[model samples]
Target: MIPWVQLDSAKTPDGGQELRLKQRGAEFSIMLGTNELMNSRLSGSEEALAKLSCERIVGRSQPKILIGGLGMGFTLRAALAELGADAGITVAELVPAVVAWARGPMAALFDGCLDDPRVSVREADVGHIIRSDKAAWDAVLFDVDNGPEGIVYKGNDALYSAAGLGAARAALKPGGVLAVWSQGPDSGFARRLKQAGFVVDEVKTRANGKRGARHVIWIATLA
Candidate 1:
């Protein structure tokens, strides 16, 4: 039995909470208080976030997208695997330490995906990126918090609000996708996506491959 070791910690942008990076043998986890934000071993739903989104814009040439969180790089690696060489992905990770964890202790888990030519990592708020652009991305994926309710960073809740959803809608190209990962279901979130003028599909996925905790991913298509 291996014990978990705390490698490093970082504060949320609002400074109300702290994120801890822990490692147990070969496995890694990012924790917010007692809640585990992400685990290297449980990436099924996160991978699905990118896979489902990239799957939607199959034929679009030189597709470009924005990913809200860089978690354990599951979404980024999944997107890189699904997208062609021409595709582009910008990942906005709010906490610099998380990015450092990706390139540092969890580098093996990331597997050099950060160095991929099509990928770019930014230490900024994804919402700002969403607001600054208009019809710029073919897909916009979010895995920032536990759900639309927010856990790691409370300010991220705005990214799921009516106005925030509208900004996301405006950031996408016509028929583009907005894929969001959540720990559980949120009926109000689905409604907000619909109210934002998106054709939505609520998908239930597992934390692991075919087992583990059930997670949700909202595949909202801007049409």
Candidate 2:
């Protein structure tokens, strides 16, 4: 069996936690304390987050999309694959090291998606991006933290709160989608999405293709 090797570490923006990159043979993982935030080998749900959201806005010409987290670049790559040449994707990654890892040890996993002409990477909080724009994005996808509970950084909990949902609603264009990925389901969060004036759809997806643990994806659309 191959042992996991630590490649690098970076402090969260809040400076309360550290994110470590570990590699075991060909597989890679980003860890926050003992919790594994993302793994290169298990990206099915992440990919689904982008695919399902983009499906909702595929008819729009040159759709503008905003991705909240860049975990392993799975969501970004999936979105790039689903959208046309004219579509634009803005990926807001809070931790600068995660972006650096994509260019470093995980470069092959990212597969040059960062260099795609249609994509722009921002080193800032996704919430700030959401609050700054008004009806700007056709789809807003979030794969931040361990769902809405915020395992890595406590500040991420705001992204799931009522105020956060309201900001997200304001950021989306009419009929736009807000897609979220979670390790498991939260009925309370689902209700919150509805309270925010979105038509919510809770989807169950597998973590690794057709196998492994089931994950949840919330597809919230504004009328």
> What C-alpha lDDT, on a 0 to 100 scale, does residue 209 get in candidate 2?
96
Residues 78-103 of candidate 1 have per-residue lDDT tens digits of 99999999999999999999899889
Q: Write the per-residue lDDT of candidate 2 for residues 17-122, one digit (tens) a residue.
A: 8999999999999898998888888989999999999989978998999999888998999999999999999999999898999999999988889999999999
Residue 86 lDDT (model 2): 96
User: Least lDDT summed over 10 consecutive residues: which range in candidate 1?
Assistant: 145-154
The TM-scores of all predictions, comma-separated, are: 0.99, 0.98
| Structure candidate 1, residue pairs in collision | none
Residue 69, candidate 2: Cα error in Å is: 0.7
Q: Model 2: residues >4 Å from true position, as ranges?
A: none
Where in model 1 is the C-alpha error above 4 Å? none
> For model 2, what is the alpha-carbon lDDT of residue 9?
98
lDDT scores in order:
0.93, 0.93
